[model samples]
Target: MAAFTDSDGTCLFNLNDGKRELVNGAEAAQALVDKALAGRDHTAITRICLSNKSYDEGAAGAIAEALSKMTSVTEADISDVIAGRPEDMALRVLAAICGGLAGRSLSLIDVSDNAMGEKGVNACRAALEGQRETLSALRMCNDGLSASAMEAVRDLLVAGDVPTRLTQLHFFNNMSGDGGAKALAQILPHCPQLRDLRFSGTRAGRPGSVAVANALAACPAATSGRFVSLDLADNTFGTEGAAALATVLRKQANLTLLSLRDGSLEDEGMVAVANALRGAAPALRSLDLSANDCTGACAKAVARAVASCTKLEYLGLEENDGFGSAGAVKLAGVLGGLKQLQRLQLGQCSIGTRGAVALAKSLEGLDCLTSLELNGNAISEEGMYGFTEALGAAGKLSALGEMDDNNAEASEEEEEEESEEESGDEAEAEEETEEAAADASVDELTAALGGVKM
Candidate 1:
């Protein structure tokens, strides 16, 4: 042990359990052979952070090589290494982790913020295809993985016919556009056990969004819904694409949480989506559809649909083109009927004193809202003051966590929801006096969830 430590080699300290434990494992440990290496604990010894300051290439190799000879470590955290700059050698170690089937028990592997190019992805693919028993979740977002790399991995997953065991995949802020989206579409049907999927900033426009949701909805995989939680925010899903997912959501009754923030959904698209949500899903809990082009007329249609989605918990409708006082008033009308809404967001939606007054009146009867956001719309100082006063009276924002949809109405009903607060009723008188409303684009609406920002 002393010789290896002195030689700057990786040392595995074994206890009564006969398992090797690395020392001072804080830095490169997770990256070295994260999936390959796991720990075994006993009362006689506890694993400590491996000292990474003096680490060398041999150290990484040693870790990977050692993985083949070890077994039985339940608590494996490899995110620290994935947080570092990519090194070919380190990725090799990563390859070895899966090569040795070490990820069998790995619950999480953080390979984010690294330049794990196509080669690295292939290596990880090899590991994932190994079908390690204990591997349950993976986060490969923000790793500078290009569209080609995603496509490459997707092809491998299909061609290899690997079984679906992984439940979580995070790919936030990655430029995995159309190619990546297509690749993922092919795999979504096979992965029957998926739980959390994040495709933020993947540039997955209309075709990809529509294709993926259609695949999921049409396949038996969706019916099983062993899968849950789908976050496709910032993917620029236009109105048409969003409506496609809306159809899927109708069949997926088990999904609990969904986020499609910052996707450019339009009013007509929202109308289609809202109409679908009224009776399709048997078990959807929360949804977000913020930042869309849903103006007053569109918001009214959506409000009408949400009035009947009894299981919805949260809703976000911010930063759209027509979500002004008129929109708020109509939304307020709908809020008057929702009995289960827990959260609501309406930020930067061209709200003014009249809108604020409209919202305040409709929300007065709200019993479940706990959080609220009115960040950047035309909600003047007076409007904000009134809005705040109403919230103080209501005592909640329901359960809203995020609000981002280019045309909040265009998202696939992932994170936004409906509620009948006092604001809904306050707008009734105004709504009765309203004039003709403009038509919204259905094509543009559904694609909003594809991350179409103005």
Candidate 2:
């Protein structure tokens, strides 16, 4: 009964409505294919996920053939399904889908964790050539893609016959280094619709990161005010790379989400980014400076950045041990005015009891704040108790509204009336019956529905 479904109710591998509880072997695969083929709305099969399914080559080939016949499938995830075999078998399984899905209007394709090495990528390149006009997203994370395979991917990105529609690309945990990054940089200006790009943990060093930053800066979409999100975490991009991206941030008005976690963006680089936010980046909402080496000196810059961003919502500063009590107090000073701020993560920042109390006092002013992560900090029982008391007092103030002490007796009488209603009197109660039980259940459901605010 496990499956994946979209908001539109289109699903893949959903056996919930099927007659059988469980299915197995090539026969079950064929049955699944038959059901798909017999369905009137083949286009409803927008996602074909065979992840973690135990099936043989015959079953895989049948499913691939069935998928090829579908009129339109936007997203397909075939990760970890071709297990217990050589990489070539996995490549063949992918080839079948690529052949069928060629020239189809498939937007997103994920083949991560399949161990499909260079040959598999080469085959996918051929298959993807037909989808040059339609494919907008491709995820090949942890698939053993090397620097050589990236050359083929680069060619596909810059194919001259048709304008590339790629908007999102992920190559996380790949073996590609500066060479692969340079290849990708050449096509960044070509993809005007590119919104989300991730190269985390891909061994893209300083050179690679700088190249990406340059390409992003030169990209027409970025310069023309199209919103874009870029994640370059764990790449060891040093101060020079961070400075280059800071320049990009100053120019790219639509650049919203930027994640440079686990990189070498220390105090200097952090200050550079914060300065960019303070000067430019008005539309910026989410900023993740986590796992960096930022110290307390960068706190004022970050606070200024938050103050500048009137619509800032999510700020992630996790694993930056340099931000101690002083930094927390500095940040708390400005958070009172950020009515739009909601999610804040400051885990492992060395914030002590005093800092926690400072933050808790600020939290009272932020009515929009909902999520706060403070794990791995130095907050003790007293600090936590202070936060609890402050938050509880704020909750009561919000709940009581305009009610004053003068209405205390009226409130008590109302509570008594509710208690009486909850514990109905035996003298006036009717005998319990099947109809009464059903009516009570209906009443309970109605009351529950009425209690819902939204």
C-alpha lDDT of candidate 2 relative to the true structure: 0.67
- lDDT of every model, 2 decimals: 0.57, 0.67
What tens digits encode model 2's per-residue C-alpha lDDT throughout 97-207? 566666666777777776666687776654566666778888878876677777777776677644578788887888778877787788777877777787778787778
| Model 1 worst lDDT run, 10 consecutive residues | 1-10
How high a TM-score does candidate 1 get? 0.69
Writing each residue's lDDT as its tens digit, candidate 1 over 307-392 gives 54556678778767577766777776666555567677788786655565566666666677666665555544444455567756
